[model samples]
Target: MTDSDVTISMFERIGGSATIDRLVDRFYDRMDTLPEAKMIRAMHADDLGLIRDVLKRYLTEWTGGPRLYTPEKGHPRLRQRHFGFAIGDAERDAWLLCMRGAMEETVTDGAARQDLNKAISGLADWMRNRT
Candidate 1:
């Protein structure tokens, strides 16, 4: 089948697990170092190891890759899980800042990066729990 006839998943388009690993690592690195991300960074645990693993699995499944997170974590219930944190517009912006930087660093496909950015931007917006 021609490329036009093929349905490519975001996972494959973005170069799969390797890219995902790099993306998540870069994302957390930004969160850990970027001054702009301080507010959201404060919401995370001091140790990022566990959350790093969780995010990798979640992003893998969310991007239409193999099922890794759901089987272990059940439904993402992302908003519910994050309810303990105070996610506002500023928080979302900080998150997007880190994520966008990570995407730029790891997701090589331009179109895939843009699409993932849009989808993730929406998720970040929806996560806001404050004004």
Candidate 2:
């Protein structure tokens, strides 16, 4: 098999759009309910609808599924967009708690889950703008 044939995108391995939606929903749900997520959840608006959709699209595209986020929103520029938020270690850890919980509930495959966790952990850590 060629590289293209052997290489499967995390998006595909994670079950494409349907699973992405589920993961996003679970992530937000965890954030909404978990005490560990209170700090990060407070940074979000009262209504999570918009961010939920945006994240679904972003994760879809980020995992090599489709170009759903960039065409409308332009570059992700994640850190720049998040600059207004004071994301210290506590905030990052809080965010990761929600995300990791979501991943545990959604991504069944062990390798895919680990890969996603590492990538998301890196992203959450990068969002930290404070000491």
Candidate 3:
């Protein structure tokens, strides 16, 4: 099979919206409880409900599932949106730690899990604003 024919979207591999929701929920759960994630977690409001909804939408779109995010929020402009935060190596690593844990718990396919980790790690690295 050609690359186009063989390759499935990360969303499909991740079992679509329901699984994505579970992953996002678990990610925040880890962030809430993990001491390593405290700095990143402090960046959010006490209630994770709203952020979880936003993440579900964003991840859905990001993983090539649907366009739920932009219709409501316009451009993601992720870096601009995150400019207020000081995301150094520590914060990025902590964020990745929670995400890696979430993906491990939610995603079953090995290749899909690895691909997701690479993509997420790249994004997290990009989100870093400090030296």
* TM-score of each model, paired residue for residue: 0.96, 0.95, 0.95
lDDT of 1 by residue, 4-80 (tens): 99899999999999999999999999999999999988888999999999999999999999999999999999999
Decoy 3 TM-score against native: 0.95
In candidate 3, stretches whose alpha carbon ends up further than 4 angstroms from where it belongs are: 1-6
> What is the lDDT, from 0 to 100, of the residue 107 in candidate 3?
93
Candidate 2 stretches with Cα past 4 Å from truth are 1-5
Model 3 C-alpha lDDT per residue in residues 36-129, reported as the tens digit of each score: 9999999999999999999999999999999999999999999999999999999999999999999999999899999999999999999999
Residue 86 of model 1, lDDT score? 90
lDDT of each model, Cα atoms only? 0.96, 0.93, 0.96
lDDT of 2: 0.93
Candidate 2: tens digits of C-alpha lDDT, residues 28-92: 99999999889889999999999999999999999999999999999999999999999999999
In candidate 2 the C-alpha lDDT for residue 106 amounts to 91
RMSD of each: 1.1, 1.3, 1.6
